[model samples]
Target: MGLAHVHWLLAGIDEIAAFRLVFRDDRTTDVRGTGRLVWHGRTLVWTPGGPYAHLRYTVAINRQRPPGTHFDSYATPDWIATRALHLFPEINVRFRTGVAAARARLRFRLPRGWHSATALAALPDGTYLVEEPGKRFDRPRGWLLLGRIARYRHTIAGLEVTVAVAPGSPLDVRGLFRLYGKTIPLLVGILGAPPPRLLIVSAPDPMWHGGLSGEDSFFVHGRIPIRSPDKTCSYLHELFHVWQPFHPSADGRWVSEGLAEYYSLALPYRAGRLSPQTFVRGLALFERYGRWGSDLTRTRVPAALNNSAPLVMHWLDHEIRRVTDGHRCLDDAVRSLAHEGGTLTTASFLRAINQAAGRDFTPLFRRHVYRGEPPPERAREDDAGVGH
Candidate 1:
């Protein structure tokens, strides 16, 4: 194991003024340098006066609401589900001339009979490996489920995918598994891929009735329908969060979101779970809803625009195919954004679309994205066929 040297560490948990870190220890007794510290009003600054420092702190668990719903983070006498990112703090480290890459791993010491799982790769020795490919410093990310629970795992596409559901949560884990078996393989290729490992945590009431995506994992309310009435699948929607090539600005966020939603519909259709006619109907609904939403450029728009955004993406794909004579589509455009190598912006999105289509797409984007104009209604036959 490699130690991460740090000059300082800082962290502030949310709603912490009420539940504070009342116990902590700074183990820097043998370090060199001033070993000095400074404190300001309600704020303090400190350094171990050495290259490395270790600090341990404890916070009271402000456990959440009664079961049957969902909570972001919660605790019970029997189990706990919470984000691991909050436990790791911000640290600044220094070397003589440069920075030392920090490698982090997580090992849990639990109460007797308790077991823990994380959205991290489990090593043979039982420790979880923490890694972030583009960063010089790697910290653990994802949710942690600790306690006595039902643990089920599967190897999908050779990735260890674990599903941990609190006992008696009433989640349809079997249905979830069946869905994964049917859709995961095809979606894996469509999605670029899943992370090295995947963790899914679920519980009944006392948790949010929704889904949340973490580093390589995510949480879903046990009873939330996997496939909603409108034909959108929350399962597939959140799965897209695992692999985002570039961070998108607010203006470009629609692209990222639209793609996720697009796949939610397309993945099912492509997987044969949804028929062509039904898929077409779903797209029409989105187009109608999007017609009332704001321009795609706005950071804040009518909530209805969520439907609009995906419609925009579907049409964008349609346009890409037409312009390139079926040689390219939105997938190529999307992949180009990653290849372009920067934060996704409107300009960058346009460049990608143009590059994929081998033509200028300024007019198309100008009318729909910038001006928020709805696409011209096409004859049903025109929109009938979906590309494979």
Candidate 2:
């Protein structure tokens, strides 16, 4: 039998504390110029001993999983899978000369029978390139998967897509590709920027029961279907998270999640793959869970808050459409929010809404999200003033 291969993106960069790297040789293998590596406690410090200095390091791709428990990253003898950010250690160093702005390349030397894929740009000669203009040291971040795996690669609607699964997964990879190919393109107009590539990895029972999203990548349990009979889709929800450009603060967590969950059903509905009655039923399912949710502004469990969040988006989208005479909709506000950039806050979210609607939605938010009062019901499609 062969190993599994998967691609990943860094999901939680803000909370990564121990950016650990695995070493195999003289630590100076990837280092250059005049700098001495210093170790203080568990932290590694570096300083330029001379002009024109650069440092580099390598990480071991192997990870050990707990025995029969749910985890995001884990490994068996046949393969290794986890967040690249957790695998590659973050470096802290400075340079006085030479452009600190340089691109990073990842070249792999896998076992004789193994294959691998990554979320980074595929360069000529089979290496991956990592270049982020905003950061000094572009650490290898995102999901990293390697094992006796099978990879299905495609280019649909100009987006590079890779679906990796264990050799015998029951997942319908072809159906999933058809679904994503049909719906992901629909998000570009409203979401502003779609990831140039998307990495989807599916494994078996030992993984968490749900899906988790990373940068341009997401992990899902193999048992999950393309679409449930209830009309909700875990794959779509996580894919939305990867496609999302804005990062909302704790107070506005629902804005990001609500949109992701809402669009999971909405995109297929808009694509005519899901019936209108089924779409409405999906919203009702979210509403049913939402009734048990706590306040939106508090730091409560996100799953609990998300039950009602999509219904709120449904109503808000309708409200924006009604007032704008079909000229603007919730997408207008979402675009506005995306333009603001940086960490998204509740105030910024409200400002985006007002900017899009040309009116205040503060009272609405105060009534619903903060006070825990239910948002008003969405009007009928035709009366909503926006074309479906």
Identify the candidate with maximal TM-score: 2
- Candidate 1 lDDT at 256 equals 71
Q: Point out where model 2 deviates above 4 Å.
A: 1-38, 46-68, 97-100, 291-293, 377-388
Report the C-alpha lDDT of model 1 over 109-149, residue by residue, as the tens digit. 66788888888878899887778776654666887787888
Instruction: Write down the RMSD of all candidates, one decimal each.
Output: 7.4, 6.7
Encode model 2's per-residue lDDT on 169-200: one tens digit a residue: 67899899888878877877777767788888
Question: Could you tell me the TM-score of candidate 2?
Answer: 0.81
Overall local distance difference test of candidate 2:
0.68
Per-model TM-score versus the true fold = 0.80, 0.81
Query: Model 1 off-target regions past 4 Å?
Result: 1-44, 50-53, 60-70, 98-100, 188-193, 291-293, 302-305, 377-388
Model 2, residue 170: C-alpha shift (Å): 2.1
10 residues in a row with least lDDT, candidate 2: 1-10
Clashes counted in candidate 2 amount to 14
